[model samples]
Target: MFNTIEHINKENRNWLKSFYFIHKLSFRTLWARKASWVGTFIFSCCLLILFPFGLGTEALQRADIQIGTFWIMNEFVAVLTISRIFSAEQECNGMDLILTSKLQKTSIIAGKISFTAFQIFTLQIPILLLWIIFYNINSNILVNLLNNLFFVSIFFNLGSASLGTLITCLTARSLAKEILLPMLFFPLQSGILLASVSLTIHIGNNSLLGAFSESAWWTILIAYPIIFSTLGILLSDLLLQE
Candidate 1:
C-alpha cells in the first residue's frame, strides 16, 4: 500500500508539472497577440447577436430554428477558434522554440489545447450573456440552455482542438493550414451542430426528465469529443514528425 501510494504521488507530480508548463505556454501565445485575440472575441460576439435577427422572428418561434441557430453559431466559432492554434505558432516562428524545448510533446500539445479552450470559453461568455438577455426564455429554460452550451462547448472544443493539432502537425507550414483546416473541420462541425440543435429543440419543447430520457443523440454529442481527443493525442507524434 505504501509503495502504491508513492507511485501515485509521483504520477500526480508529473501530471501537475505537465499542466503547469502547458498553461504557461498557452498564456504566452494568447498574450503575444492580444489585439488579434480581442478582435476574434468581438467578431464572434457579433455573429452570435446576428443569429436572432438572421433567423427572423418566424424562425425564432420555431423550436427547431432557435436550437439550430445556437448550435450553428457554437460549432462555427469552435471550429474556427481551434483551427488556428498551431498555425499561429508556425506563423510567428515560435514552433521551432517549442519543438526544441525540454518540455514533453504531450505537455506542449496540452498547453495548446488549454490555450484554445480558454479562448473558446472567453468567446462563449459574451454569446451566452447576449443569448440570455435577448431571448424571452424562462429561468428553467435558461438553465437548460446554459447546460447545453457548456456540454456543447466542451464537446466541440476538445474535438476541434485535437483535430487542429493534428492538422498543424501534418502541415508544418501556415499556408497549408489555412487551406486545409476548414475543409477538415466543417463536416464534423455540421454533424455536431445537427445533433446538438436537434437535442436542444427537443429538450426545450419537452419536460427535462423526458429530454434526458432520450437516448442515442445525447450519447453521440458526449462521445464525439472523447473519441476525437483520444485520436488527436494518439496521432500527434506521427503527424508532427514531418
Candidate 2:
C-alpha cells in the first residue's frame, strides 16, 4: 500500500511517489512471470534478425540509406514488445488486481509502462551486438550507435506503453481485450517504426547526430513519447473510472 496522499500534498510529489511505487510493483509482478518474459525476449531477438532481410543487403550496406535495416528491425521488435505488456496481464487477470490495490491509478499505469520499457531495453541488446559485428563500426561510431539506440528505445517505449495502457484501461472487462489491446498499439508502433528506421539510416550515414539532438527528426522522436506519455496518464484516469 502507498503512503496516503493528503488533500494538501503537492501534486508533483504525489505523482512522483506514485510512479515509483507503480514501477516497483510492476517489476515484481513481471518477475513472478519469468517464463513469459523470457519467451517474449527471445521472440524479439528472432524478429530483429529477420528484419535486416527486409531492407536487403544492398540497403544495409548503403551509408546514406536513412533509417537503415537495423532500425527496421528494432521498430518491428518494438511493436511486438509493447503489445505484449498489457495483453499478457489481461490474460492473467493481473490488471484487476492492480486496479483494486490502494495505489494511485497513475502509479499503476506508470508501473506497467516502466516494466514494458525495461523489457524492450533488454530485448534490444542482442540486436545491437549483431549490428556492431556486422556493420564493423569503429569505436566512436559504436558509442554513437549506443546513444541512438538508447533514445530510440525510450521514444518507442513511451508511445507503445501509452497505447498499451490506454487499451488495457478501456477494455479491462471485455472478453476480447487481449486482441483489442494489440490493435490499439499497431498504428503507434508503425509511426515509431518509421521514425526509428529513418533515424537509424541518418545516424549510420552521419556520426554527428546525437540521439537527443535538436534536428527535426530527433525532435519528432523526443516529442512522440512526451505527447503519448502525457496522453496515457490523462486517459488512464478516465479509463479506470469504472
Candidate 3:
C-alpha cells in the first residue's frame, strides 16, 4: 500500500512537471512568433470592422446580429490561432521529440489545451472591446450583463479550445490538415457555438439570472467544456502513441 501511494505521488509530480514544461514551451513559441500572433489579432480586428459594412450599421442594434457577428468572428480567429498549436513543433519535429520523451501524454494535452484556451481568451479581449465600441453598447446594458458575459466567455473558450486542440492533434500529421480541420472542427463546434450564442442573447436580453432560467442553454454551456476536456484527456494516450 505504501509503495503504491508513493508511486502515485511520484507520477503526479512528474505530470505537474511535464505540464509546466509544455506551458513554458508554448509561451516561448508564442513570444518567438509574436509577429504572427499580432497579425492574427489585426486580422481579427479587420474582420470585425468589415462585418458592419456587410450587415449595415443598423444591424448592430439588433442583439442577435451583434452577438452573431461577435461569435462568427470569434470562430474564425480561433480557428486561425488554434491551427498553429503544433505548427512550430512540427516544423522542427518538436512534437516527435515530446512524444518519445518520458513526459506524460495526458499532461501534455492538458498543457496544450490550457495554453490554447488562455491564448484564445486573451485574443478575445480586444475583439470584444472593439465589439462594444463598434456597436456602441449601452453602458447600462454592459454593466448589467458584465458578469454573465464574463462567465459565458470563459465557458466558450474552454469548450472550443479543448476540442480544437484535440482535433488539431488528431490532424497534425495529415497532409490536408487545413482543409480537414475546419471541416471537422466547425461542424463539431456547432453545439457549443450555438449554446454560447444563445446564452449571450439570453443574457443580453434577460440578465444572468434570466439566462440561467433557460435550463437547456445553461446545461449546454456547462456541459460543453466538461465533455470536451474529458474526451481530450481520455484520448490523449491513444492519440499520442506511435
Best by TM-score: 3
Report the lDDT tens digits of candidate 2 across residue range 61-128.
55544235556555556666665665555567766776676657776667677777777677677767
Q: Model 1 — TM-score against the truth?
A: 0.80
lDDT of each: 0.65, 0.64, 0.82
Q: lDDT per residue, candidate 3, 97-191, as tens digits?
A: 89989999899889988888888888888888988888887676687556777887788888888889889878877899899999999989887
| Cα TM-score per model | 0.80, 0.74, 0.92
Candidate 3 residue pairs in clash (backbone atoms < 3 Å): none
Residue 113 lDDT (model 1): 67
Candidate 1: the clashing residue pairs are none
Candidates ranked by lDDT: 3, 1, 2
Q: Which candidate is the best by lDDT?
A: 3
lDDT-better candidate, 1 vs 2: 1
Q: Compose the digit string of candidate 1's lDDT tens values, residues 1-242.
A: 99999999987777678669767765676667775467766776777678768777667765556556666666656766776676566677767776776555666666676677677777777776776566555566667767776776776666666666665666655566667777766775555555566666765876322334446666766776677666666765665553
Of 2 and 3, the candidate ranking higher by lDDT: 3
Q: Candidate 2 — worst ten consecutive residues by lDDT sum?
A: 205-214
lDDT assessment of candidate 3: 0.82
